[model samples]
Target chain A: MTKQLRPLMIGVVGDSAAGKTTLTRGIAQILGGDATVVCLDDYHRYDRKERKELGITALSPECNYIDIMEQHVNLLRLGQPILKPVYNHSTGTLDRPEYVAPGKLVIVEGLLSLHTPALQRCFDVTIYLDPDERLRRRWKVARDTHKRGYKPEEVLAAIERRMPDSERYIWPQKKAADLIVRFWPPYGYFDENVDNRHLNVRIFQRHTLPRPDLTAVLDHSHNGRRDAISLEKDVWSGGQPVDILDIDGTISREKAAELEQVIWEQLHFSDQLHPELLGAFSEGARERHSDPLALTQLLIVYYLLTVRKHRPVEIT
Target chain B: MTKQLRPLMIGVVGDSAAGKTTLTRGIAQILGGDATVVCLDDYHRYDRKERKELGITALSPECNYIDIMEQHVNLLRLGQPILKPVYNHSTGTLDRPEYVAPGKLVIVEGLLSLHTPALQRCFDVTIYLDPDERLRRRWKVARDTHKRGYKPEEVLAAIERRMPDSERYIWPQKKAADLIVRFWPPYGYFDENVDNRHLNVRIFQRHTLPRPDLTAVLDHSHNGRRDAISLEKDVWSGGQPVDILDIDGTISREKAAELEQVIWEQLHFSDQLHPELLGAFSEGARERHSDPLALTQLLIVYYLLTVRKHRPVEIT
Candidate 1:
């Protein structure tokens, strides 16, 4: 039986609270059994306590082992297993290392995955999450305080201190990314107190990787759902020409479903992969679905599952 | 600057408490900054508590991430860095991972280092520690109770439970080793109260790699010490044709020094590397020197440093 020669790798890079985990989870869930999610944060050179003592931010290149990260990612890209460390986010300590094997698609999610060219070459598809600063701070405070055992003030302070490293190491990686995904509050559409579930998503598709064409479907599918979906060719950050796809937070369910079908069909395995797992987010105990998140997730998975013709992922 | 294409690797494998660490430490200490020591135990899939819950022995391949180990070893062989996991033996937990860069010589030490051909190929030289079972048991009991936080009875029980795995997974790996090092109490010469530092060492030189010629020195160096050093061609375990070099624990200080000088000359650049680190071992908290161990360690370092001529390891 013939296989894909090597496992497909996708790198999802972003700052903390940039919804990278949420986006990667949706893609993995949508891809079903074909994806393995690896967090690059596990390769931190220093623990949280050690970082504080050393007076270094985790976002700095010096604070992480980029060389080891490159080797491990290359190994996974070649369909080899790696002893991946487990960083206990809640306890802020590195726990036991886990044996991680590559699936047909390896989804590497982290802050500095695209920081190095060596790391960038390992990924078949790359994404950079660029959530607006205000929304990211809000998300960080909520997630860190509730799930990561941090006080809201500590979370805010960390974000404040991480700015220099974020610009030096993180923001520049967007140039290496195939897609730059941004979620932001639509100024007049919602007040400053807008909840996360209603944020609009704009996907900047670069020429680095071939992305799905949604303009034809967009022209016919909206069906009176105002500003629900649109495809526009524009110059993004750093004057890079990119094809942008926007999914409005106020999009109606029926219109969102139609756009989802177009992107899902573009991925070419609608009958094989289920759609129920897409776009599900949690707020404490409450689970909610966002149309914008679902479309963004489906678009990202489109890049993953559609890169090559089907050879039966089961064989790989 | 021209240098060796790859870093030289040495694998020292054995069952628990087989003197792998002691041998590797001496080699690294003798080689000074040119060596990096990696313990295979850090690739364990289950921690001490989890191993107990699962009722699986660490000696078994199932308890360790051998695939990950193979990949990481390959990376180091290419003069690469690895995010190596640090297993805390005292706490019986896997703690923070360490970022380990390959030095000129990487001394990989632990059980199952030579368990597979993939791992075996990574080593330029391989040594297996096969201390006599009784001596090994004594060493394990002493070590586990004092350093590893276990009772003597518990250590004995663990050794008993690990026997099947040791036979199945550990013993067979000796065939892949270039040198089989055995430390034991000489039956007729020593009583049951013989200490660890006084144990005799038998070096089983396999024909896998070109070994140093110690026969010329051994022919005349014995002078007055009975069985102080001897080279004998014999069939070792499983009818393997082996050249055995035996170092008696009771060698005279002058004779041991002469043999050490012979082996030291064979290694080249005796002026470059200091000879003080070879024979040091701790009996409880007291530092002691052993003639047999010093010779055995010098012999291993001879294989490592003499494998290739002076290409200036500093370039690597």
Candidate 2:
């Protein structure tokens, strides 16, 4: 009998606190309740004490079971299930392996998702979160110090220790990305009072994959003018040619909806999908925010859905 | 009295045989009879014999009256008329000066159009033609050998002699362009049997100016496909970030017309302009070919008109 068609796989790779989980969460929400999510960090072979004794950070490939990760990726691509390992961040220890069944859509996110050529080939689409170093450091310190019970000094020290490994292994993976997303402050506008809501984002849509065209929605007069969103073509950075979509953190609710409307109109198959699920970030049990984040999530969802539609029909 | 508002100035700069004249001619046709066209080659102080005797090529700044060119550009910017010198290519000699008055639009085309900051600052828009070296050399040899009474070997020798000057003076002006246009053969299909009609063009829309949004009309899947046209984002060349719009030379007439119609609809004010006047190349008397050339010309016209719309109205 012919093999059954497997699930669509998307890989999200980035440095720690580079917003991989946030991006994956937004994508999962858009794909509805059925999409399965996995983290490659779960493949870690050493606990915190073991890593400390070995003098290697979790960012190093040597600290993880790369072979097992590759095997699991291959299995998932073939519609087979795997017992996935778990690394508990809070307790800094390894938990029991949990059973994971491939679903219609599978999102694999972690630092080393694109590390191996075999693993990279398993992804239908790949994204790399490349936020500014300063912002990423801030996010890491805040998360570790508050939620993970690590002191501020300890978090800073960990980041410093991981820098070498990140540069050697994690950063090079950016070259393999179909999209490189960076979040930072808008040019000439910087304030200490700014929060995540006030941060601007630059999404670099690479030629590795077909990108959603934003030319119709791009406002040419918006360059250097104050606009919540803008599209720039042919921006050169470090000798790489990239098209940039700039979304201001201060984008208004009305403008955000209008932008979403434009994107939604292009997604003819997404009518059944709830529009409200996009661009959402929750704080505790009560508060949620949406603006530029919603727009960013909407673009990603658009790309994923487009890839699905273009996939060749399989025979069983 | 306050100086009268000048006509819109557009500078088209490129190296020798880079299709600057063809592009300028198309724009002139689209703009109708009122646009004043000036060739900066008129500013050449030395004739062909003089340049040869001086052991210098016309590409050198020292070979041209740059001070006079700057003064004329300044005068044109203020809506004043100038007695512009004429360099007669047919006879390889300087001709009588002609009176030139600024009209609704002024197009200045030549090698040094953007060579000086003062001249560069006078234009509302600038375009740089950067065709492939092999294609440009072919165009140069064909044009000179056929029309200018030069032998094939003579044309090639002239090109070789001018290489250093072209590199030192002409190519550097590409960095100042708001748009860099390159027409070449599509990857992998190379044959001497192909003509100009089979050349593909990549237009790089830089972030330096506000670019018209073409997202709604962009066909992303056309990148590697056999589509007649496509737009790609985040294409890196020599490590620079750029958005590319590729127009296949083999694009069918129907497809070209359809693409032109889409662009024309966006140009709401061009109702009086005849669309047929675009993308024409002269051979003898009446033979004309239309394909991707027409579509490329339409986009440039669209951009020029858009810039005119945003220009602030002057009170009489």
Candidate 3:
């Protein structure tokens, strides 16, 4: 007569090219193969031609079955399997629905994962990537032109055209997030020629959940003054306060290792988390690297594990 | 036909009990005796009793002569005099309008100084006080119950009643500010027994104005981690990035003095800005204090002096 326990749900919501996929991939790698990633982008009701003909961008909620997504999220939260719709990104067409079973961890990531309150409430942790607009546009251009076989001008035009819908749909969901991850060029280092490796990341820890206490690991002596990394208490617009943890792109390998050790020790997992798997991202045999990306993934993993440790015995 | 030099205008706007007067008084004290402060609260068309009778709060635009205030601000920016309305807080009645001439520095502090684009454009610098709601309510309750002769219940009722109007009118003006000053209880120090001197202050330097370069004086080594004072680059909710300068309440006198000296040296004023005068505020001969408040005042003074030094030769 006992109810079955559900998988731990994490939601990652952001605009196109806001690094949602990379973030999800990193966290999944850290959690090992037991994690399942569900791309809500697969729920797109229209193909590229249909969207173009209708003059509607993929960012618009009207273009997606939001209610179905919400229902699926609720079902997944109850440890149930669902036939999820699939949309092919490279082919720009709808694919057949696939049966997706709940795993130990379910990471739902896409433009509208947090658009509805019901969907938002389903996740134990929700993250929104909010990289600088200029940086995001550059990422989009690089991604669409190189991988998606789109001309540079077409990608730029699509981005510009999607701005209104992005503002209305994707951006507002940022407020609902438990954590907001923003990647930008470091202060005084913003230049047209800056590399992605040189971009700093800021993680805004909203007061919605119990955040990991980094006091033991944080070098208080080098507090807000250090260029490598810092954590600060801040207030958001509308007066909602948050804690901002900033990681510089120039963080030394030694510093990164030290930080990783602190977080790993705190997690107290019986199976030690592999350090190398934390920030690993690859593209066609080429490895892309970022220390900030690793730390962010580790932080999300910490939250997931904390939820698992604290789950009610009855549910288990 | 010689053109006259205009007064340097600074606007301070916030909701009631958001500490507008204290901020203005400190800045005026630092600027010496010649500075003139104009209370835009004086421009209220309806007296306290009248507002209550009409079921209108003081926060609403309709209850105040915003047009007259805006016109007067324009005149003051041009060093012109105006017969400004006076709302006597002690009597809850409107007195005869008084003729006021602009000094070298004209500080306009009240609820709606930055409400209109016309009014906002008149100031060399515009500041908005955005104290925490809980802390601000505590301040309001204390002030209304003591100075304004309102019952505790009455004050609480008034705050609740004014919420809709405050939202409609007062909060919207925050977006127009060049700097936002937020005073709050530090994280984990929100006990009822905590003293006001122990509160933290955060200054959001918006992208509206070219902020003073404090890199030479700021201890960047301490970054966002110092127990006393720290400065950080941060992003606002709507994705407009800002530099957040945080001042801890427990900042040592020595640390405060050292910071003050660094700022003063950078100003290079022929008439040395007095350290004691910088952050001075009084309550019935009992001198109340805060190091963060002093530093904030000094920063404003630096901005004012910078504008003065850079004014066109024709205007001078």
lDDT values for all models: 0.81, 0.76, 0.78
DockQ of 3: 0.00
Q: Write the per-residue lDDT of candidate 1 for residues B1-316, one digit (tens) a residue.
A: 4665577789988889888777777778665677898999888878889999999887779988888788889888878788887777777787777878888679898888998899998888889889888888888888887777789999999888878888899989978988989998877755557877677889889877776777766765665637688888988667778888888877778888888887776677667776677888776667888888988888877776667553323334
By TM-score, rank the candidates, best first.
Answer: 1, 3, 2
- Report the alpha-carbon TM-score of model 2 versus the true structure: 0.47
Cα error, residue A169 of model 3, in Å, equals 0.5
The residue pairs in collision within model 1 are: none
Chain A TM per prediction:
0.91, 0.90, 0.92
Q: Each prediction's Cα RMSD? A: 3.4, 28.5, 27.1
Between 1 and 2, whose DockQ is larger? 1
Candidate 2, superposed: residue stretches over 4 Å from native: A1-316, B1-5, B219-225, B235-241, B284-286, B313-316
lDDT of 2 at B110: 94
Residue B75: error of model 2 in Å? Answer: 1.9
DockQ of 1: 0.64
Q: Over the stretch B189-277, how does candidate 3's per-residue lDDT look in tens digits?
A: 88776567667889988877767788866662243446456678888688999988888887777877787778878884627455556
Instruction: Give model 3's TM-score versus the native structure.
Output: 0.48
Model 1 chain A lowest lDDT segment of ten:
A307-316
